[model samples]
Target: MMASQRGDVSAVRALFVSQRASPYDVTPSNCGPLRFAIESGSLELVQFLCHNGADVNTTFGTFETSPLEWAYKTRQIEIARFFLRQGARLDYLCFRGWTPVVLLFQESSPTVPLEFFGLLSGHSFSDFDVQDRFGVTALHRAARWGSVGDVHALLQLGASPTLTDNEQRWTAAFWAASANNVATLKRLTEGAPSNFIDHVDFRGWSILHVAIEAGGLETMCLVLELGVDPHQTIMVESEDSCVMEELTATEFARTKGQATYRCFTQALQLTGYNISVIEDSDTELVFWDT
Candidate 1:
């Protein structure tokens, strides 16, 4: 395992030959030799292990991640492609319901090959909307990270923007709302049905509410222009640590906006007005006084 982890192809080969070590043995660490080789980013060692009957589909750790997932996590594009050619499942779920595609987007680096994404997209079993244990899909991950390109790619691969995660039932739009990612939200809304953007969480926090509290005035304006109701309200609990309060989106925005700046009130008024009035105005509106 140490040899493989160190990318020591020759040493691994020598140890394997001398000890008759089986590459298929899953160690107590929940990581197999092939998975270790993958973590080393050594293409040669990985190929050798696979040739020696290393199970590319073997899952380990709490996430049940396969070698293909390890490849994606390690940015081992060639190894990833090799595993795919060897019949690795495209939508294999790892820890927390994360598929390789979902995990790929979770990577902090941006240099991953487009071909890899394309390969996963081309796979017949690639379930674009496959959710994690949290019910968060690739779209949710991409939206949370502000990964616009990956969000677009996932959508093109037939990922549904309407699907929501388990707990909050927050759609991709809602994820974008929480993250204040207007560009990603716009991409998601493109060609969507007129009413598609009108959803809220299980708590009844409207898209307008989310946009206003987490997003700035521009985002609030965008959501309203996209046809969200500014008058939307949800009954939220805990006014005095135990009481419930029903607040309109406008009022909620004002309350939340006060913590950051005084300008959120203006945002509420702009959207809270009759939609007809906003549409009729030719003058540009400023949300804040600089």
Candidate 2:
């Protein structure tokens, strides 16, 4: 901790040299010199630890997390690459809800090693898109909270937008829609399903319905451009438990919880609030997850 905090690479080097027994130990919370350096953005210290025989691929403790994952997650993309070239596997999925890609994209603009990110680009995978405990993919996180830079990095790394999570639902398209990021959504759906936008959750609403209900005009327009029919009809069960003609986006959402009718009802007029998706159904009223 002292050496890491002070950025004393020399003392750290002498203490952990391979020739020594090494009184200090590496750990997760109290990461050894390398992790601490990565954590603190001390590239100098990181270089020292690596030169002194720190295992670049070592999992600190909890989550089986490696130095590469931390470096990626905390904006040390270069450091992550250094670890990877030293024998870290870029695709290794740990117990935590993260792969190196997840770590790379979680921040506004995560650290992306140019050569490494470039190396993973131009790749493709039918089954490599893995999800963590929440059933979210690296693509999901990037399109949701990441910058265009991060988006481009993962895209180059060959993350599959079509990959689904554990729920057997939610593609990268759904996540982009929910995030209201039209640009990223456009990039992620290049070769997806024709009715991909029409994919309803356990419920019967499609992605367009979600955007419309959420008042995401940009997202709605993008989906429409991607082939979502704006005038599609959706069945809604009224408060009286009776089926009704729900035209426009708000009604469909209100009845089914798209955009809370009561919560944002006051500003419902924002997106032609009164208008909603038209309705039609077999019979029984049921809630669907989108």
Candidate 3:
């Protein structure tokens, strides 16, 4: 383990030959020697360990993270590809119920090459829309953090942007909007169903509502321009079950306080709403003229 962590191939080989250590030896924390080799970024050492009997698919840690997941987490694309070629399973769920594909997107740098996903083609798995335990898919992760090229590659590979997660039932477009990733949002919604942008979560919060709550002024304006109704209403249930309050997007923003209220008002104005602003000693008022 020490030699592998240091990436000393000669010392590791010597230990193996002298029967001093085995490739399957793991740390007290359940991390294997191959994990150290991969973290050391020594592909040669990794190849040697695997060739000498280290299991390429060996999982370590409480999450049951596979060797391929380690490579992806460490941004070792070549090592990851090697593991995949060695029959690394993409379907293995980690502690978070995240598959290898979701991990790839979640852990990879934003600059990861588009070709990175192309390697999955050699693998037998085709369900790119598979979700994690949280019901978040690879596409959702990509939309939040990946480059446009990454999203394009996933789409080509069969990841569905329309799929929603378990918590919020938010599709990739909603995730992109919440992250203020307008470009990714546009790319995801392109050629989508007519009602795609109009989708509301379980709470009846639209993409515009999500943008406002996330403090993304630009995203709010973009969604409005994209045709989300600014005056769309959602029913908010009060503590009294018999009393329900109807709130519009602008009204929802008001409850978030002054800064958010100002932002939403500006977004409405920018999108061509004839809003009149009035200031009083105690409160600010806005009137939308139809």
Global Cα lDDT for candidate 3? 0.83
Order of models, best lDDT first? 3, 1, 2
Report, for every candidate in turn, its global Cα lDDT versus the true structure: 0.74, 0.62, 0.83
Off by over 4 Å in 2: 11-30, 110-116, 119-128, 148-157, 230-248, 253-290
Model 3: what TM-score? 0.91
Candidate 1: which pairs clash? 63-95, 96-133, 97-132
Pitting candidate 1 against candidate 2, the one with the higher lDDT is: 1
Which 10 residues in a row give candidate 2 its minimum summed lDDT?
Answer: 119-128
Q: Candidate 1, which segments miss by more than 4 Å at Cα?
A: 107-112, 215-217, 261-263, 266-290
TM-score of each: 0.84, 0.70, 0.91
For model 3, which pairs clash? Answer: none
CA displacement after TM-score superposition, residue 245 of candidate 1 (Å)? 1.3
Q: Residue by residue across 1-290, what tens digits does model 2's lDDT show? A: 56675767766667666544242465447456666678777777777777766777777656777788787667665676567668766666678756665666654564445554553442322222668897888777777766556566666656666666566377777777777877777777766766577677545567777665556656766766676654567766666757565655444545545445433333333434343333458332222223
The residue ranges of model 3 lying beyond 4 angstroms of the native Cα positions read 235-245
lDDT digits (tens) for residues 22-126 of candidate 3:
898888889888999999999999999999999888899878788987887777888988888787887776787776667666633665665556666666667
